[model samples]
Target: MKLSGCNLPGITVMVFVMLSSSSTSAITNFNVLNFGAIPTGGTDSTDSFLKAWNAACGTADSTFIYVPKGRYLVGPLAFKGQCKSSQIIIRIDGTIVAPLDYGVLGKSNNWFSFEDVSGVSIIGRGTFDAKGPSLWACKASNSNSCPSGATTLSFTNSNNIRINGLTSLNSQMFHIVINGCQNVHLEGVKIIAAGNSPNTDGIHVQLSRNVEILSTSIKTGDDCISIGPGTENLWIEQITCGPGHGISIGSLAKDLKEEGVQNVTVKKTVFSNTQNGLRIKSWARPSNGYVQGVRFIDSVMRNVQNPIMIDQNYCPRNENCPGQVSGIKINDIVYEDIRGTSSTPIAIKFDCSDKNPCTGIKLQNVNLTYLNKAAQSFCSNVVGKAIDLVRPNSCL
Candidate 1:
């Protein structure tokens, strides 16, 4: 610890950030409670935690809400703004279980919800078990009583969030969702899901900015990381992904209009048995959006299907590929220093739409070995390459 200097614009922020050189005081105090002591089995501990937190913090900008050891069985704990930009050490040696019934809320509920807050962290070695099979099965069967479960840990309309060293398993939907948030950091977390598990994505960040996902391991059914619309300045580094879909940006603007993703960087990552190593997906329709300033650098890939895919005609409802193109425009994308063994021979496929084609693309020192055969999409206006394979078909 050394002395630091800074100019203060706001006194509250000075106290909030605590950048003073001479102080030895820890910024936060612990308010510890064990759910096991409460004798609650389920998300009830979570509900109680919220109530206690509300009383403790009371909209005072933030507070450190500490949960010490013990097993807490809870379902879908919603945190709107209890610990905003504060040290929230729900320390390890504890389990937060989502009740057996609260299915993934793709359309409705978020298991762990955050809204309109900043400088918050959910840290330490804990487990968020979304005991989500009973409801998933019912929803899969099209039961009218079943609700949508799109994401397990969903962050909505917030900023400066951090999730570190946690384990999440058995999600009814996407393992983690960062939606409409900014300045988020996820470090040293492990998320697991089955390969055939429907929509079980590892980390899906949408409509956010300034996000960092580093040193995480993800195994899931869907893309390990899916960057969606209105997202910018995202960095993902040092991650071990797969037994799933590789890193992806977009499935952009599935049903919405005016969505754009920009300034994303993925570096020093490892992929194994994934479908696509580095992928960008945009709709086939002519929509009003653009993805710009994207880079994937220094990554290792193994046994991935279509190791690199740029699909503009994403999610075709009916084949014969439509003429109503997506309004989304992609620009200034770069992939550098990538070596990979692709499970499919269509190692690299660019499906840029005939209308509103991709622009300002650069691929340098990329070598791909695909076993699935090759079929290259027509790059009408595409330019630049150290591109190895573009075949979208199989060797068979």
Candidate 2:
């Protein structure tokens, strides 16, 4: 496969083939715990499961702590460098629920939290239920008095995480979050929060590096993937997004200082009924950060607003926006293999600041068809046209 040419839903089914390579892989120990066979329905084995996992943390390619078919109630499961070399795989065959009133740990509403950990893999075909009714009620009554909710799963200050074949549902906040972590890989994951749910982003990644999300389907109330600050070498492929905002860069960013995001790529992804497509947003103030080397290739956008947007003047909370352009430059963005239908006429908009005009940007081999009409970009003050880019700039 041509790395960048593969389609979503196509590559996900082949995860086992590409992911199971023995080339410098994690160590393995198989400890199968059939939650159904154990006959412990009422008792929560959160600690027992962790004990079994720790005992089998030998260095091997197949270190698996399998949870076979049953509703096993668990508490927050944490992973650190200690479980790093174990190549951990928790094959959840059934549902994993939390104890009552724990509030799914720290999942949704207000700010979510993540403890420090690294080098883990949570791959399973089962469901992780946050069961967030109590938390929801609290939020419905008084947003201020409720305690912070926990996520169903979080990747915190950790690296080399591979999440596959899982249905992460009804998280208190974001379904999946990667924060202060590096070298993360998400494949064949499904995240679905309640419709019109508040702050329920499907996959929110922040302060991370070298992250790859592959063959995932995300449908949430918020952005399918909200890429936050300090991310580098982020690659997304074969993703199906809908019923939310499409792959966004940021909504709130302080400065272009330690907040640089580079080498971002989204390819072979299909977006349906999304708010935006191929979005890059930034705040205009003390100019604390920069976003560079962003690309969206081989993508299809449908019934989306703003199929392409580069908004430099972002902080949209106030009618009269503040902050002068502090020269947070954006460069090297590419939109190619784009075939879509947008509901709106002004489907493609790049509102880069005049002070810091979007430089080194290109739209190649690109054809955007919106409202039964074909469209091409008419940019202003761009460094290069779609064809004159340093990278190959073509539409065919």
Candidate 3:
């Protein structure tokens, strides 16, 4: 059976076709246009998209949801599953735009959320325009009535997922969030936002395992990639980041008993004019958390501030955890072949927790410079070793 058509203005249409007995023989396509979705981005297409998702998800056959070449205005959408079809693909050739007024999505949690899904692949050369400039202006003006912004895209409690070639622009908050998931891969993804936009992290991963982010370029205000607690076996490579905070692990130790982050590898990356190149930060609080078996290798930095850092007493603005010390144990970290130009005098800083000092930190073949001169290194409450021609005089 074949299904394809566009609906008339102000009319909602639902098309259904019976499949053959052997569903695997053919892949069915569910286009949102047939379900009354407006292509001009002037009207709400949330219901139309949801209907298409529901129909495609309910089928046991391999299904494809197609968003054709047009601009679609969508509201906050939650695509939940425990789907009947294990192999479902959503291909978008159009741009999905958020409401012109950021408040519509700002008050919500996520613009596009996928929860409890498995074996779903989203591949497209599409764009997600979140219209975040207004929200950033509001927050910049210290507007107390402003809502906490929503993430542009989020995947939670999902497994065997793949997101490829998707572009996110001007996100109100984070561009992509991977939480409570396993075996998720993101590749050839592009995230763009202003350099000073508040909290627009390119990607945030937490409570996930075996997640891979490869061949991605990010320009944002916050960390290009932020690794949170309970993330294990994450591999990030071939990434380009600039006009933002660089790759970071932690800001952990939030709770008294927190899950640790382990086995993360970030290599073959490049950073330019960023706030921090490679960092691991945590709040100064009494916690039973730890970070171990992390590696940062073969990365290049250009005019980045704090090329290498481990700030355990991360009490921003002296807010909470005043005078408190972090109890998080950070160990077994390696930085190899990191060559960089620092924007600051201190290229490397390791301010580890006094209660549980950092141990087994190794640096090899690190060359960093500041202002055409030799930079400096600072170490406090840490124990480590330097090998193979470290610059700025390793303070281990």
Candidate 4:
């Protein structure tokens, strides 16, 4: 199937020629060195990287774009596709660094982007070092000239994608984003950033479906994994998160007309020294969004704050929509086999919206403590029940 071309930065046209299923084709290798990319980190390799991509994209055979072991400096890159081959692999064993001047890539939407691509896999133990501390410092100083930092990598309007064994360090914004895609899988990924770095979510998925994230470790400033509206059929397991905000859903209800998030499952995750664990939050404003059929199971938390939380009346900094109610409905959520130690006395908090209260919530075999003492549960505008063996006393 041929995908229509879209105008991409540094790209004139996209041509994809699909390979036949019955064909036995040899893998074509496109090495960045062959395209005049310098291995040293000082030189700009943007053009060389694009040249390699173009060469690989135009081929009918299976292709591999290889990045050898060295430090390489690159700027903003967009890999747009309707490629000739159905299978393209990007294997990287090098460290890719951004320019020292943060403004060079910080002002852009993303440092590296894949758009309108399909059947692609990125593998190997590569490191993406996006030197974001300068930008973070600029923002901390309250400089009006600071640009909104760019995401490290993003995939959009694509399908059948896989990312494995990649390390991202000090991303300017979100580390990895999956947007408007389907059948995406990410595993064995590591993300590291300062705990105070602003808006640096490890992974953010939205308007996507059938996504699976497994065996990932994240230590970031913001949510380790954030689920946005229109996300469905997501599975997250075996994740380790610390020095970050734990996995969250929503901050939804920003737009009046928004999509609902449903059928999400998070299991076997561990959190330590994090802000929150297993949270669902939405803005206190008018919206048509809803969250349903979500499950958080077999998770452990250590020294975390708000181990289980639902803040439908989330008004960050109490700036917008004071005294307003959230229109997003939340229901059919379950928490099972969650054991944790909370940093705060209140281990569980359900501060749902007064207008459209949360219902159909269930808790089973949950235990949480504060300073080795009995924790507490606070509830408001929520209707739920505890099945068995609930600590901190169920307030449903």
Q: Candidate 4: what lDDT?
A: 0.90
Candidate ranking (lDDT, best to worst): 4, 3, 1, 2
Worst 10 residues of 3 by lDDT: 6-15
Question: Where is model 2 more than 4 Å wrong at Cα?
Answer: 1-42, 57-62, 83-86, 99-119, 132-142, 316-323, 373-384, 387-396
- Per-residue CA lDDT of candidate 1, range 268-315, in tens? 999998877899887676678788988888888788776777888777
Off by over 4 Å in 1: 1-43, 59-62, 82-89, 102-108, 139-145, 316-323, 371-381, 387-396
* CA lDDT for candidate 2: 0.68
Residue-level lDDT of model 2, residues 80-139, one tens digit each, is 455434345556667776567644464433222334544456666888777665666677
lDDT (CA) per prediction: 0.69, 0.68, 0.90, 0.90
Residue 216 in candidate 3, Cα distance off native in Å:
0.3
With a 3 Å backbone cut-off (N, CA, C), the pairs that clash in candidate 4 are 16-82, 16-83, 17-84
What's each prediction's TM-score? Answer: 0.82, 0.79, 0.93, 0.93
Model 1 scores a C-alpha lDDT of 0.69
| RMSD list, candidates in order | 6.2, 5.9, 7.1, 6.2
Assess the local accuracy of residue 325 in candidate 2 as a C-alpha lDDT between 0 and 100: 66
